[model samples]
Target: MGQQTRAHLTGRKIYGCGRCGTHLTTVEALLSKRFTGKFGQATLFYSVVNVLEGPPEDRRMTTGLHTVVDLRCLKCETYLGWKYIKSFEQSEKYKENCFLLERALLQTIEPGLELEGAEDPISREGNDSSTASNLQEEDDDDDDDDGDDEDE
Candidate 1:
């Protein structure tokens, strides 16, 4: 298979693959958070990125029967959710072409935001603070020596 290029999403609130951190979608594309999936809580999105759709299948959901294709992360190939291809019931027709992402399987990515199972910058800084303070104290001692020379 040829190398697949992953799509990058830009926004204040971006959702990514929980395991690989591959960009998925943004808050602006989110439609609703009141959906359920195999894992439990799920969310609906108007569009998504960096995903691959599997074969479509007819599944009977709470509302009605829907033709959906399972979606996987394009980078890691992890199953994230599914996309509605068609709805049998008229009341659920609005969900067609929409994507349903499982919340438990997704990670929210933001600037300076610490991701779960990832290294935290704040804790790393804390570990090096003592060394940084020691260097500052040495600089202060040199300043004091300058004052002593002036007195002489």
Candidate 2:
């Protein structure tokens, strides 16, 4: 499972599935959608936790809890999306003061809709235009050759 820093939700449907009409509110449903190419796959990972005091490197304790999610293909195990869970201390004066973090972060990576053995739109357009121009140039060359033959 590879980790991506960016988030993507291209194929992700904000509503339910069109085929089975399954609601995508739960993590399991989301995972299933990801695996089936409905929402697209992405690797979710825990990076770090930040406290109000400062980062752990600044003499502050980095005891915050963190969680990560990995989006992978069920069949081929390809990484796709990332989810993070973080918690921090609510106060500094309270020695034993800590609360469950109420915040959640989600990230997704979509590599664009892929079709087997088919080129993307941008590539296809360039190829078509180039081929057309090349054919035109060849026609011009043939015309010049014919004119030279006549002169000879």
Candidate 3:
């Protein structure tokens, strides 16, 4: 008999937020339920960054997903989201899947960018009172040099 081999079942893998590291389990679960009935019926590719599962193995080991929407900040190389291959029917052809969350649902999953008052602490604090106060003071001092502007 030919050697028997085990076949692995392929399924969706969930991810967490890049900035906050918040798990997207609930979001992925909900999307899985929603898409279970809609596979291969529509063109559903959308923009999203590929968050790799682990560190790069070599110099050429870029996150090898289908479509990488954005290259996140180098200081914090967090993957945002990505489109995944759903199925392969031909040698060079494959089906893909993506999540289409409602504005509310997207906000729930990635609230900081998708909703008001959902920004991260660093982003919020960057424009908060202390920083704003310093900028205002700088503007006030700049206004005192009226002759400097005319000379230029």
Candidate 3 on 1-152: residue-level lDDT in tens?
A: 56333221112422233244333333223322112111111112232332233322211112222321222222245433333433233321222344322211111233233222233333444433332233234334323321311100
The ten-residue window of minimal lDDT in model 1 covers: 143-152
Global lDDT scores for all candidate models:
0.69, 0.24, 0.27
Clashing pairs in 1: none
The lDDT leader among the candidates is 1
Candidate 3 lDDT: 0.27
Higher-ranked by lDDT: 2 or 3: 3
* Every model: Cα RMSD to truth: 19.8, 23.5, 20.9
| Per-residue lDDT of candidate 2, residues 1-152 (tens digit) | 56422222234322111112121121212211101112322211122111122122212224333333333322223332333323244532221221111111111112342222222222344442442243234333323221111000
In model 2, what is the error at residue 115, expressed in angstroms?
Answer: 13
Which residue runs of candidate 3 sit more than 4 Å off their true CA positions?
1-30, 33-77, 90-116, 119-152
Q: Which residue ranges in model 2 land beyond 4 Å of their true spot?
A: 1-65, 89-152
Instruction: Compare candidates 2 and 3 on TM-score and give the better one.
Output: 3
